[model samples]
Target: MTQQPIISLRDVGVRYKRAGSIFRKTQYYQALKSINLDIYPGETLGILGRNGAGKSTLLKVISGILKPDSGEIINRGASVSLLALQAGFDPNLSGRDNAVLSGMLQGYSRKEIESKLEEIQDFSELGDFFYEPVRTYSSGMRTRLGFSVSTTISPDVLLIDEVLSVGDKEFRKKAEQVIIQKIQSQQTIILVSHSEQQIIRLCERSIIL
Candidate 1:
């Protein structure tokens, strides 16, 4: 029997309103037009495009952050996570607290995420810094924390938007290894990147916007 898609998009379109110069009327633009996609289980899908091609927009739509102006999305109870560094984080909250909030946003219960808190802390290697407020963290420290939570919470569909090259050199290596392991372990992933080589290496299928 043929496999069914875990998520499906039918005739989806997203329109955005943009301001015009002082001499002209405002206009709307289509970021995505009549897009139809099927995201199957255990597949590493790649989305490739230049800047302004709505790559991030597509990921947000998949993650349910953006509602399409037209068409429908069929997400059959599967959870989707977008790899965002600063999303859902509060500057006043400690790293640990933010992790819990982020995981909850991914559809996990508070208890479920708290159980994995130690692992998230360990993977981030933030040590005492994990208890510190996010405002006190350096860029690298913040990146590590966000990356750890997003990866550790473990969603059914992982949506990455050019975040694989994040953090310092050592951490980047560690992050890349973990993503490789995820791909090897049959985790479904949708990655958007400008790097052709990365797409070719990690994705089983790709689409260009």
Candidate 2:
């Protein structure tokens, strides 16, 4: 029996407008055009492209952060989360607080978030810094905390956008291992990456934007 798609997108297109100076007319760019895709349950799909090729834009649309300018998206009622570097965090909040906030934003209850706090803290390996304001954190520390929180929540549809490159070598290895485990457990994922090797290793199928 064939598997059903958890999300379906047809004739999708996204456009952006650049404001014009007094001397020039406004210009518009099409970020994505005539895109059609079906994301099946429990499949890892890699989206590959260079900078400004709409890979991130496509993920945002699927995650419901952006609406396509000219097409229909049918999400089969799956909960979705996007894990982009520095995307969902508040700089003034501590890592622990951010983790709680992130979980809540992903549809978890406050009690559930509180219960997972310890696990998220341990997985992030942020130590005492987990209680410190995120603004004081280095980029790598923020990445670790963000990755831990997002993975812990385990949304039905996870969207990752160029976040694998955020941390140090050791942390990157750990993050990659976690993602591999998720794939092994048959979690559905849409990954946007500029790294060709990473895509080939983690994805069963892929498309270039």
Candidate 3:
């Protein structure tokens, strides 16, 4: 039997209202237009485009972080974990606290986060930094913590933005390993990245949006 399509989008479009200059009273930016896609289980769909190509907007729609102005997104089966580093984070909280908070926001209980806490801490390699307030962390440190906590508990679908580039080489390697394992395990993945080599390595099919 054919694997079910875990994600479906038909004629989807997202328009953002922009404050226009004096010459132009108002306008709308069309982020995604007439996009049609079907993402099945066990697929890694690479999305490629230029800087203003609406990659992030498309991802947000699929991950339920944003709603499209037109058309429909039918998501069936699978818990989604989004790799938007700055998202789901509280700056006032320590890295460790933020990890558990983020997990709870994603429907994982405190007990579940407790069970995976050590692994998240280890993978982040933040050491004493994990105990420090998030505001004290550099962008790389924050990204590492976010990446580890987000991926430690496998979700059925993963959405990754270019935030992976924010970390160090060692962290990048760890992230790649986690991604490889997720793909091999038949978890659906959608990603946006500047590295075509990484995309080619992980994804079997691609869409230019």
Candidate 4:
């Protein structure tokens, strides 16, 4: 028997309003055009598309970052986590502070964040700078810290939005290992990647957007 889908998108449509020029008329841009899809438990769903193909938009919709204009999103039995770790980070805050903040956003308590604080710090490897402001971090350092803190609290549904390009080889390796272990443990993962090799290695089924 086939397993039931943990996430179902029925006749989903996402529309965005375009920036109207002084000389031109305003318009509503269709991001996702009457799309329908399902994500099953214990499966990795890979999403591929060219730029502006609504891959990120789809992720935002499922992650509850964006609301669709039409259709219903039925998410059953799984908590979702997005790959955009810095989506709500404060640049003025220290890395350590951001870790706790991010944990809270992911539904973890302050005590829970404290418990895993050491692991997040160690994995990020930001050294003494971990106590410094986030604005001081390089893009790579920021990515490392963000990835470590975000993935530390595992979710039933993981959404990756082409963010692998933001980190170095070592951090990427660590992240990949964590995700691979999660996949083997039957967690649902939705990954958006332009790399075919990554898709083949990590996902069993893929949807081309």
Q: TM-score per candidate, in order?
A: 0.90, 0.91, 0.89, 0.90
lDDT, each prediction: 0.90, 0.88, 0.84, 0.86
In model 2, the Cα lDDT at residue 87 comes to 43
Q: Could you tally the backbone clashes for each prediction? A: 0, 0, 0, 0
lDDT of 1 at 108: 80
Estimate candidate 4's alpha-carbon lDDT, on a 0 to 1 scale.
Answer: 0.86
Number of the candidate with higher TM-score, 1 or 3: 1
Off by over 4 Å in 3: 20-25
Per-residue alpha-carbon lDDT of model 3 for 77-143, expressed as tens digits? 6677776554579889999899999877776889999899999889888999989999999988888
Estimate, for each residue in 1-209, the C-alpha lDDT of model 2 and write its tens digit.
Answer: 19889999999999998778889999999999999999999999999999999998898899999999999999999988887444469999999899988887777899998999999889899999999999999988888898888777678888888777768999988988888888888789888899999999899999998
Question: Candidate 1 on 119-173: residue-level lDDT in tens?
Answer: 9999999999999999999989999998998887467899998989999999999
Assess candidate 3 and give its TM-score to the true structure.
0.89
**lDDT, model 1:** 0.90
Model 4 agreement with the true structure over 101-174: per-residue lDDT tens digits = 98888778999988998999898898888899999999989988888887786788989888666688877888
User: What overall lDDT, based on C-alpha atoms, would model 3 receive against the true structure?
Assistant: 0.84
Tell how far residue 14 is off in model 4, in angstroms.
1.0
